[model samples]
Target: MLSQITPCLWFDGQADEAAKFYTSLFKDGKVTRTQYYGEAGKEIHGQEPGSVLTVEFELNGQNFVAMNGGPLFKFNEAISFQIECEDQEELNHYWQKLSDGGDPAKQQCGWLGDKYGVSWQVVPKVLGGMLSDPDTAKSQRAFTALMGMKKIDIAALKTAYEG
Candidate 1:
């Protein structure tokens, strides 16, 4: 069974491509189904009858749908997908893959905008613990260090926390 809520990504006639790219990023990712526009809505949708309309995919076990909804809307940083990695290697891998051809100006504090304008936060699992340490000073230090980084560095955060 799937969850009650699923994220729907809007794209300008790139649903299929986006789905393939996203599925390729995670181990458990796959495209479950693809739907196409029909002649009945030709006037309303303005898309070819056989053209792809939506693609349902899973990324790291999370259900998502990419829709070829035309160019009426665009993606913004208001929403983002956060990938919590187990270690530095895992974090770096995801960060590099997702940020390829992305906007360099938007890369800050582990947040980046992918080529498709989708924002992603590639962070390590340890970040949560460091930022939430019981000791206020340690947590503050970690937070300060985090704000200064583009990609998260687990080692730096640990050093800040221990300080």
Candidate 2:
């Protein structure tokens, strides 16, 4: 059974597009369903009848829902999806794909904002181990090196930790 809790992403009439884009990026991803705005919500939502209202999708086996919630609210950096990559190649792949057309200024410390304003962190799986090492100096070094990078580099972090 699918998990009861799922992240609901807000979009300004781009739920379907965003869902499709995300699904294409992951191996186990797929759009499960899509719903359209109907006549009942016309007075309040102002969305054209039959326009996309919501899209349910899976990315890396995690379920999510994207809704065309209008422009009243905007996506901020407070919420972000974190992809724990197994290696540098995996991390680079996700970083490149997710950051395409995204704001370059927002690219820092493995975090980026996609063109649609959704924030994401493409990180190496070893990042947690490096950042939480029992040795404080090693952990600090790894943390410092990570902060200086746009995309997390596992080799750079290992060098910093060893130094």
Candidate 3:
């Protein structure tokens, strides 16, 4: 059997809603399967008789599972999905969708709550190369530029580090 480890997002009785919202965000992905409480051959769950058990879905080629696992755990900024965009337009599209229930941090980056309190980062790939330059001078310049802004500006970072 093929096996893969996917991020299992825990939601407080809103797994279905979160799954639907996430499926709507990305064009390349869709909801694959969903298991509810009273479905065929389903295990018995307490309190909520016919609640959602798990939601299996994909977003931008990544697989994720959402569970109506009550309020045992919560999402924080400590973990986030980094979306590498080629340009501003792509970034804007992702940013707008991900930021639906989020509060903007500043510049181009922000912390999105998703419908499930999950956070994701919309970043530019160019920012990685600029920040990881072998030359300390270039790296420093990139860091300086990145520190001043919330949403990363790839063009400005390249100009500062390359020049």
Candidate closer to the true structure by TM-score (higher is better), 1 or 3: 1
Task: Give the residue spans of candidate 3 off by over 4 A.
Answer: 1-3, 39-47, 105-115
Q: lDDT by residue for model 1 over 1-163, one digit each (tens)?
A: 8547899999999999989998888989999999999998789889999999999999887899999999999999999999999999999989998899899888998999998999999998888888888999999999999999999998987898889
Worst 10 residues of 2 by lDDT: 1-10
Candidate 1 positional error at 98, Å: 0.5
lDDT of 2 by residue, 1-163 (tens): 7547899999998899999999999999999999999999699999999999999999877889999999999998999999999989889899999999998998999999999999999998888988888999999999999989998888988899899
Off by over 4 Å in 1: 1-3
Per-candidate local distance difference test: 0.92, 0.93, 0.76
For model 3, residues 53-163, the per-residue Cα lDDT tens digits are: 999999888999989877778888778777888897887787777776675652244234454567777787787777787998999988887777666666777787876
Candidates ranked by lDDT, best first? 2, 1, 3
State each candidate's clash count. Answer: 0, 0, 3
TM-score per model over all chains: 0.96, 0.96, 0.84
Query: Who is ahead in lDDT, 2 or 3?
Result: 2
TM-score of 1: 0.96
